[model samples]
Target: MERSFTVDVFKVVAAQLIVWHHFSAYGPMSEAMTLQWPQLIEWLYRYARLAVQVFLVVGGFLAAQSVMNKPMTHPVIHIFNRYLRLVPIYIFALSLISLVVAILRTDIHADWLPSAPTFSHFLAHALLVHDLFDIEALSSGAWYVAIDFQLFVVLVVLCNRLQPYGVRVLSLGVALLCVASMWWFNRIDELDIWAIYFFAAYGLGVLAAWAKRSAFDAAVFWITVLLAVGALWIEYRTRLSLALITAVWLTIKPKSRVHWTPMKRVVHRLANSAYVLFLTHFGVIVVFSALWNIGHFHDPVTAFALTGFAWGCAVGLGLFLHEKAEIPVHHWLSHQSKLMFLRLTN
Candidate 1:
């Protein structure tokens, strides 16, 4: 199936927003920045949480589409393929952090690491259940990965059992469940934020996949966008949960085709590297912040610039890893998956 340029563009923008969200955290910016730049960085950050929702939706749509089209008899092979895709890079990131801790003698939290490098933690991470149970942090930002994996598992089972109708029902059910869960768990400080956001956003994506071409009304689309913006503003003021629900609904419309020469190519590449970027960017920031003495750079301008540079380095490294390690590993895993499927079927 041909990939949607609209989704690709959204992915790229979302990844950039993720980077910016982290960068803003590192910078010495105030809440007034939101008031000053209502449209650009401020507003984006205010609603930036929506980007992850977009990703989850896209993931659900794609995963359901693939599974419905290609029903795997031995799903374990497919699961193993996913394991191979993520675990190596996760371990690499962990190793990098371990090295940093050893070298800097930083007062790092031991809870982040496994008590014993025993098969349990590795298996937990390999299965993407580490964060679900709060076992270990393979990478600081691995909660999303864990949530994605869990959603994929749930989606696969639902798709196989319910077929096409399963996709629609699951999508709607999860979306409602997401909202309900948020309402119920709003007071629970220890709830996993990634899981909640992923379920809601991914449900929307599944809904989009099952959406008929004629279902999209331009009038409704525009109105939804306006509502999303309005909801975001209200969210900022009242911290109401419905704001997120509105924003998720607005993102379901097909993206417009905006032509740009090198821009598309750049975004596609970034989208591919988004996983690596997410996993490794924190370490990059820590390293750069240490080197630049970000503490000394009290000026927000200097701090933001330095943070951008750090993110750039992280993106570059992620791109490098994607080209050199991730792509090759993915290819190998795909091949092995096919072989494993054949063996199992035979």
Candidate 2:
């Protein structure tokens, strides 16, 4: 498949929004600056939650591309590959968060900042069951990582099962289940751990991809559009609205053809580093806030600049770790996965 510049751009923009959401929603810096620019902070805090929909939609779209026309040779191996890819960086983020939370909790106080991790909390995080077990999120937004994993596994099974039947039957069946989820399961916040709650958005992504394929019937796309509209008609869900819009955009996207050399390179870099940025950004925010407090940078101009600077640092740090830590772990895990898959197949 050709590299999709459109998807790359979306990832970079959405990742930036998520980063901005955290900076403006947490700690002393956001609180201090809220008074200075209430509207800006409010926009970041409120609207930025929609950025998550972008990821879910994109995830579903990509998942379809991977499994739509093919059988998952080893579904368990595929799921394990995703888990290994995320866990190393996630654990790194959690450790940093726990340390930062411990140090900052001494003097700093905010509802946004999490409390110290207990033994069960650490264990739950290590196992990626923090959300399911009601343990506090060590790093902000870390719950999304687990949720993303669960969504992927569910889609893989749904699409890959009954491979002898056909894509239409499998995809349509999955879509019906997803619609049921959107109307019922997702409304219950307590079911956050399970993929059923988020399957509607994720399924829209899968169906959109099927609709986008040149060889497939265009009706698939229309079906996806209707499901999204129906979800909104049943209930006014802001997240669902964002996911529907994003899924539509992904469905109707042009091929990845970059005309400008410089812009292409920058987009490529940011898109590749988006996941790393998401995992590592909260630590930078905490440290930045702690520094600002200790240094007593209370002036409006300086405080605003501090927030912006920390934002840049967070992206930079993620890029650095992507190269230094995540890439190595990803490559190693992928290699191990292939070998494992081969052994299983043989």
TM-score, cand. 2 vs. native: 0.93
**In the order shown, what is each candidate's alpha-carbon RMSD?**
6.0, 2.0
Q: Give one digit per residue, the lDDT tens place, for model 2 in 47-82.
A: 986898888888887777877666686788778877
| Residue 282, model 1: Cα distance from true site in angstroms | 1.0
Q: Cα lDDT of model 2 overall?
A: 0.81
lDDT of 1 at 124: 70
Choose the strongest candidate by TM-score: 2
RMSD to the native, candidate 2? Answer: 2.0
Model 2 residue runs over 4 Å out of place are 214-217, 343-346
Give the clashing residue pairs of candidate 2, or none: none
Candidate 1: give the clashing pairs: none
